[model samples]
Target: MSHPTAPPPYEDHNPLYPGPPRPGGYGQPSVLPGGYPAYPTYPQPGYGHPAGYPQPVPPVHPMPMNYGHDYSEEERAGSDSFGEWDNRKVRHTFIQKVYCIISVQLLITVAIIAIFTFVEPVSEYVRNNVAVYYVSYAVFLATYLILACCQGPRRRFPWNIILLTVFTLALGFMTGTISSMYETKAVIIAMIITAVVAIAVTIFCFQTKVDFTSCTGLFCVLGIVLMVTGIVTSIVLLFRYIYWLHMVYAALGAICFTLFLAYDTQVVLGNRKHTISPEDYITGALQIYTDIVYIFTFVLQLVGNRD
Candidate 1:
């Protein structure tokens, strides 16, 4: 030991061999046993971070424990029942509104028909001045087109009411004029038959499972057939009135309009393939009214003893 410790026992240092442990443990540089160059050491990392490094923290905020309460069975049932009731109420209201409008229109038409039928002076004047009938017919057609085809005018507030009133008046005048040519007894009978048929058809449509609203193609075909038949009948009548042919045409018209009444009623009811919206109450009333009036006209033509 006093002789330079025998020069540390003369070891051969190799570059690939591991060095001796140092006094500073794993993180310090250490020399080999043969005095080789010191190699650097680093601390090993833990599971999620470096052994000596600080861990990052995430920001926190309060969260609602229960966002919404679970509805009980009774509460859910109550909600469903309420929804059904509300829907039924709305539908009932719409139907009532449509019927009220129809009632007023019919009343106006009935008054006009009475005036033209009973008032001899007015009837004579209407017959003498055919121009008045033509004018009223023109007005009826114009207003009918606007209401039927133009949604904007039909749905607009005051304008819709105004146009509908004018349309009804013109139609009433035209109807009254035609009625004036028929005997009062025939008109009254026709009115009775029309009212009975309308009531029966409406009741049937409301209760029946048959969906007449899906018969659009059938309706169109019927209309075309009716129109063609009427044109042929008119030509025949011009040559010479055949009583049977006229009767047949009138019967066909009445039947077709009766079907139309059923279809329109189903549409208004909305439990069908096709339906009119609740907002289109005016349109619905118009359809039903037209069907009834046309039914009356055809019935009158079929049964009336012309004056």
Candidate 2:
């Protein structure tokens, strides 16, 4: 034992090699200020020790240390800026379209309505009372059908919105004027109430936190039913005495259309995808405007009919 010397320790130097397994998770129980671990130490991958020998400090590279993944503040800021720009562009384009669609449609519609409504008083006396009204109605119905069904390659929605609005105003004015002979203040008041309700529903969709995406399908089904009911009722009016029934159908139409308005607005705001096309912002606005106008008119009928 007096002349015996131990053999030199073995050394292996490959970075990727998984060294001897640790008894516990590594990098835990952080070293104390003096470099001693608070608890028993776990060995790093290259920290080999023979029996009864103390651990040695391993080699560190000249390159920067990589603790798996590290994020720099500069890199994080650049990524955030790019993301914000893209989102802002999308939102800005969307809002521009919204105003363009709504404004064009409303202007055209109001112009047409003023031309006719202001020219004709509701109390004007006319011969062949029923025939003239039917002809006037046919003109409006034809216009509405073209606006609803005509979807072509050209950006016709703006033109259509203009046309539809013009016709809508005409219809409203004529209806309002003629109904004035029978129009108690009640009907106009009813219309104002309906407008308030419709606007309230729209505001609630945007403002209130309750999610309304699920109601889209329900609104579409009810909208179709309301349109069909209006058509069927109009047809049946020729065969029977049901003017009061028309008012009832009108009320239902108002309710259904209000729901459609809520659903459609949500789509424009990206909350729903109820309609297939979104690029034609005007078309969507017109659909909403048409529904609201119809609801207002129908609501007016209740006021007009009330004794």
Candidate 3:
């Protein structure tokens, strides 16, 4: 090889590209490294060039803003959201249909209970107090409240649903047959009240969309208070103390209970953390069902007393 070339003379030094920060006024024109393919340089139209050149315009549209990292990524996210929405809609729809079927089932159960009471040629007193029928109702309501609202005693929802169904069916059947102090007209009035409360509470749930999860603890405390108050009032009434005050307490209790039902139902329907199973649907139906039935029965008793 030839001897190594000496450092270039002062005027001959050709530094390769002068490194990045150019010395002249051309401070690297904010371009991407290769200048975006040079944007097609235009030639001057003098010297017999196409002077009247009708230059076709470059297309001005930008490449789409990539919301996704890849095509499959966008597609996957879109399909997931759509699928979740669709699944929820279908679940609610099927639940509603199932609710209707269960309602019919309850009515059939009531008819059976009623037939047993009347066709059995049983005494009226025996038919009336027949082995703590109302206690089953209390258990059903408590079961629903627990299942619909709480996360503690998990997986009991399905058993609770079956129990409530059996209880209501039994109640309906018995109530249909036996003679009672309250008339059907009174019951009808109660039904209307219950229905109104349900609708109002549901509308409130939808319109507000407020998170009331904190109120859950307060509700439990209040339920205990109501139970204790009812027991005390029952004892007092047994001693021949006519306390209309207890009725007022009960009326307010009913109102609170109605709101609770609505809020709880909304949570099951929309609360993301509360994954509603098929049993939850049954539980929800049971909640509304009891709310309606009791409010109806209560109002019926009060109305029928107008003699």
Q: Rate the local accuracy (lDDT) of all candidates.
A: 0.84, 0.57, 0.53
Per-residue lDDT tens digits for candidate 2, residues 175-233, read: 54444444346554765686687679777877866555667567668868887888899
Residue 216 in candidate 3, Cα distance off native in Å = 1.1
Candidate 1 vs candidate 3, TM-score winner: 1
What is the descending TM-score order?
Answer: 1, 2, 3
Clashes of each: 0, 6, 9
lDDT of 1 by residue, 89-208 (tens): 888998999999999999999999999999999999998898999999999999999999999999999999999999999999999999999999999999999999999999999889
* lDDT per residue as tens, model 3, 185-242: 5544655676677678767766775655446777777678877877877788878856
Question: Cα lDDT for residue 99, model 2?
Answer: 52
TM-score of each: 0.73, 0.55, 0.53
| lDDT for 275 (candidate 1) | 73
Predicted structure 1, TM vs. truth: 0.73
Candidate 3 Cα errors over 4 Å, as ranges: 1-86, 94-98, 105-164, 171-179, 241-243, 272-275, 301-307
Native-referenced Cα lDDT, model 3: 0.53
The top-ranked prediction according to TM-score is 1
Report lDDT (Cα) of residue 242, candidate 2.
83
